[model samples]
Target: MTGEEGLRACDLTLAGLLHLLLRSSHHSSSKLTIFAAQQAPPAPGSRRQRHPRDAKLSTATPSYIYIPTTITKPSATLPSTDDTDTHYRELDLPSFFNQIPSITMDHRPQAWGRPRDDVYGAYNASYMNPNGPNQATQAPIVTGTSVIAIKFKEGVVIAADNLASYGSLARFTDVKRLRKFADSTVVGFGGDVSDMQFLDRHLQSLDIEESYDLSTDQAPRLNAANLHKYLSKLMYKRRSDFDPLWNHLLVAGLDDAGKPFLAAADLLGTTFTSPSLATGFGSALAQPIMRRYVPDDEAAANLTKEKAIEVIKECMKVLFYRDARSLDSYSIAVVTKDGVDLKENEKLEKQSWKFAERIRGYGTQVV
Candidate 1:
């Protein structure tokens, strides 16, 4: 029909026109059926074929229902809702992901986003304590004991034990407490092993920096005395800030003037220089022995290298029998005008406890 005839046909109302516009815009496969109050019913025994959308209405009455021709089937990649295996497989992905350990802090309790149970629960790692304080290690755990050094005719001799005690128990037996810095200076540490490692790395960085600067013609490099002064200032700064590095350090080498240099700096930043120095328990036990050999600068100037080494070995032997924190294996360094002679894994002569067998009233010993 033409446009004007269709617009005027059957006296169409506003609602009817709106309904026609909506139905016409729908999919082409959908048929529109209209039921009016004035329309007559079909004759008896004459079955009228109904559209699929209108089949649900009662035969004695007239009605209409719109059914879209396009079916919303699930995508080919998506599993059917009725398949239990598909659902199980999809759920297994998360379990697999959770089972995979993460290097980051993502598997924490709050980040897990799942209920706690024995199978998949909170991560319990020794290094991770969720509710604990966020503070660095301020106290020493494993530590080494005394570092003794003395100045003699040729250069300075330094010694320290290889023992690293866990609290009061001698746990690690092979920890070298002596560090050689820049091939000319030997630093003997006598406290917290962690802080010693930190300082060792710092000295390594300094060595690297100095090596890089060797391309230029420098007048003089850092000597043992200069290193001692630098360490004294560093310790003092840390002490003033109430965060001192828990270590007593002995810096021993030849000075810029090629004289035997021996100096000490403690955690309190106290600096002391003499012919002899001893840190930790050695200050009380080994100091006298060292002084007897090199009592003054003049005596140290006259002391021979052989006599100086004999004195240090005697002191170490006494410390091994007397000092509870001392070990038989020690690291000894002799810094001279030639270079540093470091013997890191030096073991003392075989010792015996046979004398203790004669002691009375100890470990069921007969009187």
Candidate 2:
């Protein structure tokens, strides 16, 4: 029943009705009482007759937090009709919306200041079927932006600026969405942060020997390079099937055979391998810089760890200066056949507006 109808039928004020309701239900619950193994029921005529279904339970621990359970969290029910139908019945469970008969709007548009909103559209009811065919998300909602990866001599270094934007909002920074798969694969994510998360969970389920329904050897092991190749294939297959991962991923690591490996996969399921790879704006600005260091088979074969690293750093600085979405601070990860080493907070040195002061147009320098 609506509170007003209940109060008028009982001939009580609002406050009085609420107080009585609380007192009755709170006393009846016996929430804090400690009971022994067996307890006796009161006689049929007794004021507080015990329910036969109630069972004694152990009270090893009691919560002290007082969370309101009545008005604050009440079961849904049919509204009280009028002053004549005043008595309230506590529902054993919430009434299902479908079970309620057709409810017509009353004369009062809205009791409080709430909007009297009505939805008028045909609702498709078959979506809940267990045997329903598979469906994919229509469009990405939350998404990561750019992921850039470069190869060095000792290993591969991949970095992604932590930005999960909602369309143009740039909503979430510090969303470290990049994940390392196994030994050799560091999956750097760009585009659709939620899709990245969904893929993360999906990958977590892939190596079944670790997660579920398996009984055998278990180890602190990952296979990121292998995982990367699989993802490339998966992305392309999904695109072919008319669904896509909606993420641009850069996988940096060594192949199973211990060769330096860096590859990328995109929403269209396109795949490419290089000494360095980037997605989004980085693709245009950073690729040429990386290619200078690892330009061809001859260059990549001769790439020393220090030179490779220097080239990557130079590329990052260029990206920071060029890509509006790029940041001075980023996460860098190195993966080799040995292991994966990731640095979440690496900042650029000497990045300041002091350079602007020395430039031609600080105030009115160009004369």
Candidate 3:
């Protein structure tokens, strides 16, 4: 062979061997180089410091990303709900800290000193940027759709597809955002993932004590009416500050007045008390049916919790049957003064047979 031709053949042989080595090592060749944009390391000596202050710092694990960290224990200091509005106004969370003097403790991971925000920004993900990670174009992580819920005789029920798509990708199979607060309230979230997480963290900071009024012997609860108003107000406040919780929400629970409550809140902070409400596709497809039950000022008052829940479930079933982006499995929550009940991992009916029995234009029907 000519000298040039011999060298080219050797180079190809080496490249083939390297490709085989990369495959066996379980590391794709493309992943070998770290992107230059995300190369920050933690500040030196920051890891050895102890905490004299009690600001909470939580770590974000991929699976259980948002675990609660209660700053103040509610064992002895908690108040019962019987106290008048004046009492709640007097119970300042910051004041509780002043009474405790100081809690010179750091509950961070042994290797982590400051908030793990910086630590997670590295190593955990390969191509993340401060602006966002490499997957910025990958669509939202926890997108919310409008959920319409109505109450039933025994309890309330709400449903969302067991789908958390990465944009239109249908990437995550099990992301149930509906949470039951103290077994009494079912909070259905609709919107961007980061905002949802922010709200979750904010709620966790409420000390778990403020959720209920104690004299009532109620579990920490937020009826639809209360939750709706709180979210609307918060969303409005955040928007005013130029940071919005890109979410629409439906809070279903019994209000402080001991009556069923359902309300809608949006990123703009606009809120409306409704017998039924929906966020995304539900607004277009399910809203009409929900409105049938809760249409106008007169019908909503007559609607019962049992009926509302049934209606919501029917809407979910329809969405599953109709909405191409939805799935059969979903989560459901019921809220009342007694507490919240959340159910995840719901399944839709089987449709696998339809594809197998297709009459025409079928897969691999090479005739």
lDDT of each: 0.73, 0.60, 0.57
Q: Output the lDDT of residue 55, model 3.
A: 25
- Could you give candidate 2's per-residue lDDT for residues 185-294 as a string of tens digits? 67888887767887888876775544453344553444556667678888888888887778888887776567777788887777788777878888898887787777
TM-score between model 3 and native: 0.53
Give the alpha carbon lDDT tens digit for every residue of 106-182 in model 1.
Answer: 54334564434455666556557678763343788889998999888999999998999999999999998888888
Model 1: lDDT equals 0.73
Clashes of 3: 30
Candidates 1 and 3 compared: the better one by TM-score is: 1
User: Who wins the TM-score comparison?
Assistant: 1
Per-residue lDDT of 79 in model 2: 32
| lDDT computed for candidate 2 | 0.60
